[model samples]
Target: MPWYAPRHLEEALALLAERPGLIPIAGGTDVMVDGNAGAAGREYLSLAGVANLRGVSETPLGLAIGALTTMTEIGRHPLVCRHLPALAASARVTGAVAIQNRATLGGNIMNASPAADNPPVLLAYGASVVLMSAMGSRHVPYAQFHSGYKETIRRPTEILGEVIVPFPPDHAHHYFRKVGTRRAQAISKVGLAAVLAGRPGSWECVRFGLASVAATPILACALAAAITGSDHSVPRDEELAEALGRDIAARDDIRSTADYRRRVAINLVREALAPWRSQGGFDASH
Candidate 1:
């Protein structure tokens, strides 16, 4: 296999334009696994030496995470843990330390796996993807980035440069949960994330997302509306859970049956939203 390591982002973009079949390799964890299994074809564009594409920084608006930033870095970053703990929590469960050290956020999203831990949390945070191409650059909302299973909106000439996440307001509470076959080193059977904004009692804004239950991570807009507009100060637990269960469109798979995943997804939503109900609403500290 041929590997081209560009020193600059522009050079990388140009290379991608010329060689559309060249897979971009960052930490190489996912690509290496596929290569070892004879699933990846020869030739790749290695982004490791691209000096501009690394690290996490706080921008005026929110946070800018380099596509090359490893899961290990994100999971332990003080700023990320403090501001977006749900994302940090998702990063912590991506894989063991070794895999985490070698897995990049860009690779995770570009891989487009329904079970990728970060997507649900990113969706809940209203994140965006910074895509670069020889033609130019553009930002795509995370929700619109994924087109289908293992597919994304990124053009062949474009490379995912960074992920931008806006800081949540003070009165926002976030939660994430994943159901897998076992407690450790397991891919998710079902994953869920929720963000509630405004006072707990008021709940002016509610966002819910789920993974491993559809073609891609899903935003449960109807469910969020139901919880946010309910006349009851606290959501009706049974009713909300039932609504969540019925909202999912999962198909039977090797890891779990469709019915089982639907049940787990609903239960996870209830679990994630419980804190908001208990606190009498969203807390600023969240």
Candidate 2:
């Protein structure tokens, strides 16, 4: 087995260019499992030494999170908690404290798990990823990243540079819910993240995202459209929830049944939007 650690991202990219099949490991939370199971390959590219890829800062586009930024860092960062509360919430519960301390945000993105917590929040926020290669950098919106199960649009030569989330509007509301099989260390059976803004009398347009409910994490555009401009009454909310459950595709899997998932998802939507309907604001800032 061979290991290479490059201090700079450019240097790492050059190494990757030279050795095309090397597996990149930032936080080994995911890779170590593969290695322990005799699945991780012989060649590994270590990203631990990359200094520039390990911080969170503000940019013109809301927040800029370096590729190697740890989930623990994201969970506690004031800017992240303030502007991206759902993301902060997701980061906090990713894998408990020790895992959060070492697992990187890029690791989650690159891992591309349908049960992952991060992607739904990114989708809800309409975040973009910065991909860099020997050629140049390009920003890809989160929705376009995943092509299939455990697959992404990341080319072999490119590395995720940073995650960019546009600043949320002043009145925006956010909701995130993750339902796992058990109470602890369980994978998500269903998860939902939503961002919406409304006034006292009208239901505003929204963005809804979810994971573990489909082949890939998804932005529930159809569901959002169904609820947009609808009244805040309970009957209408329940009707829309039922309609959304019907429209979404859910399948029975080892962790849970499709019927259970669909039912829970609809209920979760109601629970998440309760505050929005009752108080005319999000509970995050309340």
Q: How accurate is candidate 2 locally (lDDT)?
A: 0.83
The per-model lDDT (C-alpha) reads 0.84, 0.83
Estimate, for each residue in 230-258, the C-alpha lDDT of model 2 and write its tens digit. 55543476676666775567889899899
Cα-based lDDT at residue 243, candidate 1: 65
Instruction: Kindly report which residue stretches of model 1 are placed more than 4 angstroms away from their true locations once superposed.
Output: 35-41, 245-247, 284-286
Give the winner by lDDT: 1
Tens digit per residue, CA lDDT, model 1, 200-280: 346655888788988888777768767766765756877676667655679898899998987888778778777766766
lDDT of residue 275 for candidate 1: 72
